[model samples]
Target: MCASACYEIGCALGDAPTRGTLALMLAGLLWYVGFIVVASILVSFGAVDSTRRPGYRRRDGKQEGTLMWPSLVMTAVVAASFAASHYSLT
Candidate 1:
């Protein structure tokens, strides 16, 4: 989200970011997801201890393992919207 927002803001300021920024953002997101999966697997197998600090929870009792899909979808939507707006402005 921050990545796309930064890109859009840079565009608005007439200092658009290069493709390198997009590549970096993609790499960062992938690294994050990979780390989460590895940590979860280790915790499950008792190789690593898991700790849940006090934090807000959803009203529903359902436990969600990951929000990666929703985040990626939103990022794509924002990027597409920015591209559309950028082209239309030209």
Candidate 2:
């Protein structure tokens, strides 16, 4: 649903985003789903120790870097599109 909103915003922006931005958004969504799976697997296992186990803390910085900018960019694109449209109608 959120992904759809991003794509719809892209459409309204006249597809101004580069193909790479779209691809990153798709990849981010996939990676987020994969992260959920990993977290579930860890919860299901009773043997893993927190300190000894692999942690997303290692990737947290990179993940945030990739995720935040695109979301902000997309939201801005949507809001700007709506603003432009509203102004054009008047």
Candidate 3:
């Protein structure tokens, strides 16, 4: 959804330079790859588990792995995309 929105926004920017448009398109592609492909790989590697319920304490009371790294990577991707778009616009 967000990726498509980015692409649409890029397409709608008629006055923007070609580099800006291409940057947005590239950002959209990166969004898809980061969220879908990389996320899937992380899940397969046990880095993430979507089935776990929030605030649900396990019988063993063991703390589960944190999602900090995965989340940081996603955030970095978004930040990089934004930086690319900003630089292209300038």
Candidate 4:
């Protein structure tokens, strides 16, 4: 998803205003980097453990509920960015 957004944004550079394009590019880059840093910190702190225990089955139904919100927020950001880019081109 991020890769696709990056590609679309990159493809628009030639058409969008230089300032807006640069800002969008920088914002997208920062968002991905920030997400990675935050996820690393969470994992390091054991707030988001991914290890499996003995006898744990794939259908145990224990899911990581912490990721949904962040994923939704990220999707919204990407969608908004695309919308902004689209409108800016008009």
- TM-score of every prediction relative to native: 0.34, 0.35, 0.40, 0.44
Q: Give lDDT tens digits, candidate 4, residues 16-85.
A: 5678667766676566556556656655644434555444334666755465576567668767865774
Per-residue accuracy of model 2 over 5-83 as CA lDDT, tens digit each: 3444445444436776556545544543554455455445423433343453455433222344544664565456445
Q: In lDDT terms, which candidate is top?
A: 4
Clashing pairs in model 3?
Answer: none
Q: Candidate 1: where is the Cα deviation over 4 Å?
A: 1-16, 47-90
Query: Where's the lowest-lDDT run of ten residues in candidate 4?
Result: 48-57
Which of the predicted structures, 1 or 2, would earn the higher lDDT when compared with the native?
1
Candidate 3 lDDT, tens digit per residue, 1-90? Answer: 335435544654565568756566555556655666665666675534545665644568754656657767776776675566545532
lDDT (tens digit, per residue) of candidate 1 on 17-73: 666655554444454455456546545643222234234234574434444454456
User: How many residue pairs clash per model?
Assistant: 0, 0, 0, 0
Better of 2 and 3 by TM-score: 3
lDDT of 2 at 36: 47
Q: Which parts of model 3 have CA positions greater than 4 angstroms off? A: 1-12, 16-61
Candidate 4, position 47, lDDT? 49
Best by TM-score: 4
Q: Which clashing pairs does model 2 show?
A: none
lDDT of 1: 0.47
